[model samples]
Target: MDGLHSQQNVDLEEFRRRVQQGNDPHGPVRETLSRLGDRWTPLILMILRTGIMRYTQLLKEINSMADSPVSQRILTLKLRACERDGFIQRTVIPTVPPQVEYGLTDLGQAMVQELNRLIGWLEVHEVQINACRAEYDAH
Candidate 1:
């Protein structure tokens, strides 16, 4: 029991050390994740990858992906955060009805590449991941 407790403490300390070392050598990676690591941010980025899109267009794209889609309010909030983090740009064109468009910035383009790489890795390993989950759950 004592050995097990000591091993747990060592494991926890290693975890804490890693988390505390955030952003020193990994500013870009950490920043990107911080900006886009949300339920809807990656989806929004993926949608905008094609080209600029209107608000309703983005909403529709997301809605088509899932049955219970993201709410307008949540999408708005995520967009604002992405804009603030320099991942995206929101342009409002002057018109009678006002045309608003959202698109990715250079930073966002880079983020998209990273995200695509992550998606690729997941696609390759999804079966293994699901099998691991099933094995764990069976125990």
Candidate 2:
């Protein structure tokens, strides 16, 4: 029992080192996950996946579909954060009005694809999940 416990502790420590250490590859993934988990970013990325979109266009589409619309200030902040994180590319067109557009970068597209897979899984298991939640809540 002691030997098994010692091995489990070693494994747990290694897990922490890989995930928590800056030099470890997993640390960056953890950081990116935290950023991507924000409220409006997933919606923004999903919209951008179709094609490049103007700021107002994307904002309108997102706000229309959401229960509580994202404010212009919040949307701008999330867009800047996404651009900074290399998840989206921003292009400014010098028209009479100076239009700005956003599109998913290669990295962003890849991430959206992965996120879709997770959403698909959730859709498939939603019934089971609800049942489990009900059971847990009853107890």
The candidate that wins on TM-score is 2
TM-score of each: 0.77, 0.83
Question: What lDDT tens digits, residue by residue, belong to model 2 across residues 6-91?
Answer: 99999999988866664554456666777678888889988899999999999999989899999999999999988988999999
Q: Pick the candidate with the highest lDDT.
A: 2
Instruction: Mark the regions of model 1 whose C-alpha exceeds 4 Å error after superposition.
Output: 1-18, 21-35
Candidate 1 positional error at 88, Å: 0.7
In the range 1-139, model 1's lDDT, one tens digit per residue, is 9999999999999888767766465465465667566678889999999999999999999999855889989999999988977889999999989999999999899989999999999999999999999999999
Which residue pairs overlap in candidate 2's backbone? none
- Score candidate 2 by TM-score against the native: 0.83
TM-score of candidate 1 against the unseen true structure: 0.77
Candidate 2 yields a Cα-based lDDT of: 0.90
In lDDT terms, how accurate is model 1? 0.88
Q: For model 2, state the Cα shift of residue 76 in Å.
A: 0.4
